[model samples]
Target: MRATSQDTAGGVRRTRNAAQTREALLQVASRRFARDGYASTTVREIADEAGVNVALISRYFASKEGLFEACLAAAVTDLRRDAGDTSLEAIAPSIARRMVGATSDGGRLPDTLLLLLRSSGDEHVDNVRREFLQSLSERMAAASPAGPETLLRAQILLATTLGMALLRTSMSIQPLAAATEQDLLGPVSDLVDALLAEKR
Candidate 1:
């Protein structure tokens, strides 16, 4: 009538395996979506790459759209974790340091940035991406010294980082792509001071 210790251990193992499967799907789906674009990637490809049942995608994410959204959320969460509780004054410099340090053996964009940059073609998914960027801008504005242009400044700061990531990683533009942290930190810090620092 009651479950034994062995049964309980089996349940725990099953739960752990489910979590692993879900993560595997997400990881493969993120890369596929980034490399192939959303419309071109298929549930079967993701499952095959992750070594999971195709039905698991529907079970875990409901649909490909849901999986894409989850991947975007994970990417944003990773960027936030890397940024930590950085102050407005430190935002640009912090981002620049990370950007310059980022490396990809194939010269591809980092999965996080690529996920955000790649288009999904679905209106709803595209809107979700824009909304994430807008919310990020709002958070940056809230952290900056209050002014009429605070939001505008925050958006510009966001644009600056996004552009740098695209050029340095995706485009592999010269000098910028090869730049070191020291090469970027001073300029980025100056930009932050001009954009967000309280006038004195």
Candidate 2:
């Protein structure tokens, strides 16, 4: 028998619902993992928070480890999307703007940065975090003049970025936490120029 239009519509709706459910799981899982760390968060808690079936975690992500990995992957993708083709000269200001913008949004670290900063206490998970930072360092270095120290400079830049995010959002340090984008742009841009500038 041929499928009817109503059946086809129902199938489309089911697919949409499934996609939404998967996204919901990811968002909730990301927050839980960021706030509580992977080992400390439970699949049941994520499901209850997301209003989904507990079994759906397995259906979507296979296991808690799978869910954690998925969350990391999503966060990395988001950061990449935001960083698209930003020139070396523009990187520091771009990052500074994003860091300050994050402060406006409830004064919390972005889920992406939080995932990297938080320790899961699992060797495998921690290794993944290191690999991400290393990869990002390499990318930043590639945008600068090649030299023995270029990669090291990029790593420093990454460290500064991460440290600022932590202090401003997580630690809420006095003046830094209260700083505006304009307050940060000049200092951050100067640092980028000093670190990535070509030798005279």
Candidate 3:
């Protein structure tokens, strides 16, 4: 049988539909997970929000856990890919700002951080969080020069970022939590560069 234009068009449409459905599911899942926590958000709710059948979600992602993983991946697409065309040193203040920006609304924490915190309740989510952070660590480390110290810096920076998020978002500590962007950025930049300094 010969290929038909309608068949080709239908194939392209199906691919596009699949992408749209996946994106919709991801968007809804991120919001629901962030607002309600991982264990609380149901697949049916996600499907309802995405205006797709629950089966399609499983078709797109093997399980609810898999869909959650995709949500996590999509949440930090910016950070996952690249920060900016600058030295890791140059991005410290921005990272610091991001830490504060976690609770961008002064109420709800970010979806990414929420996913991480909520991941601990279940074994599967634990693996997701662990793998996600491991890959994240590798990506950040790759951006900097290769060495023991740089690798150390990468790990330390990851801890620092998460610690700041916890302190500022989870714990809501005083002064640091209430500080102005100007106040936090300067200190964060200095702290970041201090690690970049030649080992004494």
Candidate 4:
């Protein structure tokens, strides 16, 4: 059956409206999460700020934790894309540049990441950290040699990245933050190379 022009127009309008609503929800959630922190921000509050129903928030994000995880996952993935593959020697520096770029993008990360860092003593934070480390291990294991050397490299790589992330995003120490991208990555890359040189 062929649809009339009016019917097609209505369908398009509905899709456009839904997209706008989703974008609005994400923008509001990002701002609220950044400003109030994940633990402090409630779904109801976010929905209220977005002028959407509480039910709509659940429908979109399932839960507050889910929303925060989604946002972090998104931020991490974007950084990964920017980092690319700069070889094990150069990866650290590339990653440092990418981290600085991502953080300084005037986005939601600075505030939201600080919130996560402050909440590091929380059980959920530990669980999330474990999950993140395990995820990184799985990726490295899939790509690298299955030996102590590769495992050590994976551990060092992850630790370096996590430390940089915490320092840049959470600690916000002026000297650490002021360090040039290469200045930070040089030591990290050396550490990674040393780890990679280790044998089982």
| C-alpha RMSD values across all candidates | 6.7, 6.2, 7.9, 7.4
Considering summed lDDT, which 10 consecutive residues are worst modelled in model 1? 1-10
Question: Candidate 2's C-alpha lDDT?
Answer: 0.76
Please list all clashing residue pairs in model 4, or write none if there are none.
none
lDDT score, candidate 1, position 85: 57
Ranked candidates, highest lDDT first: 2, 1, 3, 4
Regions of candidate 1 where Cα sits further than 4 Å from its true position: 1-16, 53-55, 100-110, 121-124
**Which of the two, 1 or 3, has more lDDT?**
1
Candidates' lDDT values, in order?
Answer: 0.75, 0.76, 0.64, 0.56
Model 4 score (lDDT) = 0.56
Error of 4 at 96 (Å): 1.2
Candidate 4 lDDT over 1-200, as tens digits, reads 22222223234322225455555676677656655566677887877786655666666677776666655555445444544453454555655565555443345334433333333234664566466556654555344443645766676676666666567655577777667766767676676555553344
The CA lDDT at 21 in model 4 is: 53
* Candidate 3: regions farther than 4 A off: 1-18, 34-36, 48-56, 75-77, 100-109, 113-132, 135-150, 167-181
lDDT of 3: 0.64
lDDT of 4 at 154: 75
Candidate of highest TM-score: 2
Residue 86, model 3: lDDT of: 40
lDDT score, residue 38, model 3? 77
The best candidate in terms of lDDT: 2
Better of 1 and 3 by TM-score: 1
- Name the 10 consecutive residues with the lowest summed lDDT in model 4: 1-10
The deviation in Å at residue 5 for candidate 4 is 24
